[model samples]
Target: MFCVDALDVAAELALPAYFFFASAASDFAIFLNMPYLYPGLPSFKDMGDTLVHSPGMRSVRAVDMPLSVQDKELDMTKTRMYQFKRIAEGRGVLVNSFDWLEPTALKALADGVCVPGRPTPRLKEIAHGLESSGHRFLWVVRSPPADPADVFQPRSEPDLDALLPEGFMERTRDRGMVLKMWAPQAEVLRHAATGAFVTHCGWNSTLEAVTAGVPMICYPMYAEQALNKVFMVEEMKIAVPLEGYEKRMVKAEEIEAKVRLAMETEEGRKLRETLATARKMASDAVGDGGSSEVAFAEFLRDLEKSSMENGGCNN
Candidate 1:
């Protein structure tokens, strides 16, 4: 049977399972019992006096973290209980990351954790083909809506191309395609002509880029994206941060410069090498004898056995 939530699946089967810890390890470290693996994380001292200093998170105000987790007026006992139940029934958890990316933190999580390998593809043909064809491309990003917008614009709107930066339309007229929202991400990444990714560094996007052997120009806007940027550019050596923004609003010039650097610099070349290596590792992890694939198989087996023992039959 298909399970939407891993926690729910484990609880339903009453079997030992684990979750792959993703996102900022710092966030996970904030809980009372959990230990933070990353020691080099920035201190909240810069945030000012009002923020509470915790192991994983530091906040000047109580509202900074999720309302459900922050010590607030609302009773979160029920929510917490539900979350605990999910984890308690899990045998082990797997994170969608590599050891080199966050060695200390991954080690900490690995203390009593199981890291299933990342499932990545090696598209050598696509890469070679893209190299042969000289094309510059940009990625348009979108995420599922957390809140409704006042104006809804369709993907095919006629004036869509004009709303972008001046000369962008003309410059990319021959080489670009503007996707309104939600293009097939994996396929796009694996395509032959994708030269660079302009990404927000969401864990999935970051992992996808690594898996596809692509370098990135990071534009982190919110949440753990900033943290991911740290690992991607500084730790993993596969990306470069876009600079020259006053209030986080990146101008066209900054984008162009960073993109050019990503495409042409020695740093970019090294990043490409790193990405290629990461892609190989991810592929190994998902291959028949790979760690992630093997773990996934065991998880399925245990689940099935538990279900049968519990008089639950799969239809």
Candidate 2:
């Protein structure tokens, strides 16, 4: 499932291939059908407030579709379309979600619905937001890429004194800690002291927070994260959107408000309570007779049957 580009290799070798889709099932449905849905449209960025209907999900705003599939003319979009086409040619598609976690989406799949980066803000905003929120924090800082072309480029350690607001560290020193570049994210999420995550909504991170029973403050940076934000905040009810995140510049006030909402209010408590239950459900999903367990068994059975029919070839 990790190898979308390897399907051709499998075909040449007479081996069956499967795509283990790493994102939500809802997004999978959209991808499988993109070749048909996006032939002659204006770019999604130009389709403000227009709703797009997919077989697996309620209508999603066109602008909210995954960025890779949003523009029809770009090479990346064309590449994604080609990938989707390859995915359709595979023997089967598997998703990371369980039925209980995404019932509506999973149901549509059973019904054959589809059959298939961070900008530094001005770092001052976050510095001020954490300070103003009066909450203890652990922030991992990295230098912003010098230009758009360097977006995926790895950066050197940040110059905190130059990038952060003057006196910001001193003011927050007693309550906050900042680490350079990367930290042990899974370890942090699993820590008991960790209250909520301020995240980019990457699927792996989202799953980590969910498994840890932690709630989130969504601040999607790129790719399909914006759609994940929509699902988490609007459908899963497990996160609160960080306002102004979509604009790529969030104000300190907005951050403060969100931090307080997720940390100090009754609403925050409810979010925590909800996550506790979700954590248990997530655990159950992979346990004996649970939704994911049963679905996986069914997949294996099908794989074996297909392999046998193909005369002992691994499918």
Candidate 3:
């Protein structure tokens, strides 16, 4: 929301105003509705670190929510709630996402994705997990970020050799490719050689996976990525997460299991099927007549119209 003084100026100048949200549709929905949900969720503070479902979405937990929505006592939270409530007053809202990704939230003013039921063995786990479970894979081992701020952040900026287990490169040398430098992600995803992606669930990464029709092993870290994980695993049901390590850095065993899930299980087969559908939808959304294209056109129309009306106000 614009400031009162700014709105007053806009009104005096006879200018149209609009708000742009950079988060996922669900994130905006939760923030917009926080004023109503806050009173009922007063018990949240007492809930500690327990998983409490969010009011705006199915299967999303309190821990997945942004601090702006959680800390009702904080001045910033109050300001956030106030601003979110004002979202509707804008001429129109423009979201930087596509419809297929968050259909429920966007349509019903809600988001949702995949994985499999308990009865099946999931992608029989990643490369390591597959080997452990007697399966095969073609893995691409990328280098650690130069400054990874979250889990698995290497100590003292170690080389790829030091970061990975001893003899791992040698052992998987024939079966996999250890790419220390950058690999072309889009090209890799588009390649038929690619299968599952063990991702951190960043929106961009998730979208790439969806477009590639690749199932994911969700390893969320810092910020709204936790919310993305829940949407992918619980609501969307296209990805699986390592137990007891969604919020923290995972160790070898958990990593191995997830790899197995991605590579060998019946659950994985189902995940692939769901990803195929999501991939098509994501492709369609970005196609000429698709949602993303349409949304972008509408957003441009509003901006152009506003520019014309305000004679391009100079701040």
Candidate 4:
């Protein structure tokens, strides 16, 4: 929850508090288990080829662990993971993920998983991949940061021509459209023409793509996104992983291959079909008398009872 730190205040007031985790259940599973798992392991930098076996998901390579712990000092990592101990103390936790989408991870919590920079070279490779895929596509391009640390710093608008592969735009003109800066992401995902999504596997985008019935090409750039990629591609079977992402340079050929697989092959079709079912399941879960609706009603009831017991905040 945005007010996670306020749990102590709520406890002092005898008020119940809940945590709203914005990521996947798999990530939540990892968060809950971190206090138990992290203290025993060596620094992530020293964990080469050692796979971490957390409950509810597959073993993950040390390199695929969350960026916050990957390079931080051991004490800092302990501090970060220790938050979960408090989180576990909360009345409950809510996640922005669906039940059908993450059974294992959800079961683990219930359960509860890089960093990369956006630079010019990676964008060019993405462009080449799009061009070579020969599929209809829409891309939103942003100018790369001058410094990796200043990724959010605003700058001049993107110059697609200078950033993309030479002749790439002209070659893909008929089959693709590239927009600058932003797009109505939700609307675009819901569009009938959107066959697949090439994404960084951010939780918001991952859920949107799932709801839209669009399969994905998981190209995680940072954060727990690599973990999301694993759940989506390996557990959910709703996406295909973009190879070479861990190396921080996803090759053009790898992108092309994933694109073609998601757009043209039988496997891709199956992924789409799986997503269609998932979309309906998502709808049902949130619809009237659905799981989400029932849970929300229960939450409101609990909130109301808690408020009354606390004397309606007058105390």
Candidate 5:
């Protein structure tokens, strides 16, 4: 069925009408009234920073949000108009995540979390295989350059084959895979050969690793990633941090030691077990009769009833 806002359009047709809010409609309205509250400049130079500030946005740096939200020249009037348009034409909005992953943000959104319905048996199989085979795994770091000098530079900074310490790549070449850009993270985490993830601890990546029951070798770049590392290593006991990266250049020996610790150390083994329990809990929270699932279903029903009563839904 087709949906539209504006009294003129709705009155002209007699079809089922609905409204959906992609973000928190009230929050957006409040934010729109205070455009000047947003910072004139982007905050940190990393994705995690932006996401961290998303829940409590207030005079936040532009870099801490999506690029479009940071554009100074974009007309706020037009942005609000488009936002309202989208909200006015759908039955309900669904976010692309699960509740256990972001309880605070999801609660604020007041929208349903549409967890994908899949067994993830492959992930389990891979984890089991890795446990049995006792292999070493290394996660090549993939991130945007932090230095301004490196920012506008071309992609050909160095070959994966050239950046390693002497004989380091040769020594682990049989067990390693070097990747640029993004990795098929869920797939890799589910792979039988992956014993650990050497990561920047981006929230999404961290969640993926945690959900897969894998331990992390955290190399936080900026923003909440650093904060998340504290929780992962200190609170959750599921990840470890690389300490000497204060200079930001991760040497081969440092990488070698951390990777080994994450894979074979006694502490690392304990972390794996802890993550396994967390993984199961997360799975249960999103399962058929779980809290997230029930909340989502209720959200849908509310939208439906609201649409019937108001001739359209409300955010």
Candidate 6:
């Protein structure tokens, strides 16, 4: 609805409108494939939490699908599905990501995986991961989804002592630092000391990780994030995935293993090197003579051309 509104306003004003996807191209591929994937998918309600293999995309699972799609109860075509479907009507879709950063995932998108990009789990498992992985961690813990009734009330400080397992914080106190959710995310990512990120598979966060040149421990919670995780861990070969992560209870062992793979092991080291290259590539794509810069100029030229054709809104 909003996309169409933008299109309508642009057309009314005799202007050209471009759609920008603020995520990875791999994820954008999935959005493009959704029209095909949705109908072909097995009844998610009947087979709750099962995986459905799709052509040119990663397998989608029932559980991680958003309420907007998985709920047979809702009229999906009238909602997010419709909104995404309308994206095809735009002049062009610009993804806030680069090509080399997600090569395999992008190839899969080109050859066939239109995968894109969750939610989160409890704190104990995370605390345990930092402890057992033997890696330094800085966790920014957000309050769980707010209840609508209390949404307006100012939140109180989280009682980490009670929230985490007994003595968990004490044990890892020196090794890990658990901060409030509002901590400076971009700055932290830009910091040199940050080795790896344990992230929630959001697109903005993914771009941040790319810019900062950090590997990840992907623990997707819900929505199309499962698609993002699959692309990164299975296809892109960039981040490590947390096993049994979708189960809502990630055991300490699994968490620790993934953390180590992202932060301390040879695999972690290689991931860091890959990320270093990606950082440079991302950096180059934004400055003078960058692909993004060139593309933006071309798009503007096209827009101006369109305006001239329409009797010069910008004339």
Per-model TM-score on C-alpha atoms: 0.62, 0.91, 0.72, 0.90, 0.53, 0.84
Which of 1 and 2 is the better model by TM-score? 2
Error of 5 at 121 (Å): 33
RMSD of each: 9.0, 4.3, 7.6, 5.3, 10.4, 4.6
Off by over 4 Å in 6: 45-67, 103-119, 147-156
Alpha-carbon shift of residue 203 in model 6 (angstroms): 1.3
Order the candidates by TM-score, highest first: 2, 4, 6, 3, 1, 5
lDDT of each: 0.54, 0.81, 0.64, 0.80, 0.52, 0.72
Q: After superposition, how far is residue 308 of candidate 2 from its true place, in Å?
A: 2.0
Task: Tell me the deviation in Å of residue 254 in model 3.
Answer: 3.2
Candidate 4, residues 1-315: lDDT per residue as tens digits? Answer: 435578889889888888888888787777677667776788776796689877556777787777767854666576676676667777777887667888787666651221011003389888888888888889999888888655568867999878888888888888889999899999999999999999889999998998899999988877688888877888899999877887778998998999999888999999999999999999999988988888788888888887888777534
Clash pairs, candidate 5, are 41-62, 42-62, 42-63, 43-63, 50-64
Collision count for each candidate, in order: 12, 1, 26, 6, 5, 11
* Candidate 2 per-residue C-alpha lDDT over 1-315 given as tens digits, one digit per residue, 9 for 90 to 100: 335789879778766788888888767766676666777567787896688776667677776777666677889888887887667778778888866567777777667666430004557898899899999999999999978444688788999999899998888889999999999999999999999899989888998899899999988877788888877887888999887775678999989999999999999999999899889999999889888889889889988887787677552
- Cα lDDT of model 3 by residue, 110-165, tens digit: 22111011000122133345345333344444444456544345534226555555
Kindly report which residue stretches of model 5 are placed more than 4 angstroms away from their true locations once superposed: 1-135, 138-158, 180-182, 245-254, 305-309, 313-315
Name the best candidate (by lDDT): 2
Q: How many backbone clashes does candidate 1 have?
A: 12
**Sorted on lDDT, highest at the top, how do the candidates line up?**
2, 4, 6, 3, 1, 5
Best by TM-score: 2
Candidate 4: segments with Cα more than 4 A from true spot: 1-3, 72-76, 111-121, 313-315
Q: What TM-score does candidate 5 get on C-alpha atoms?
A: 0.53
Model 5: lDDT equals 0.52
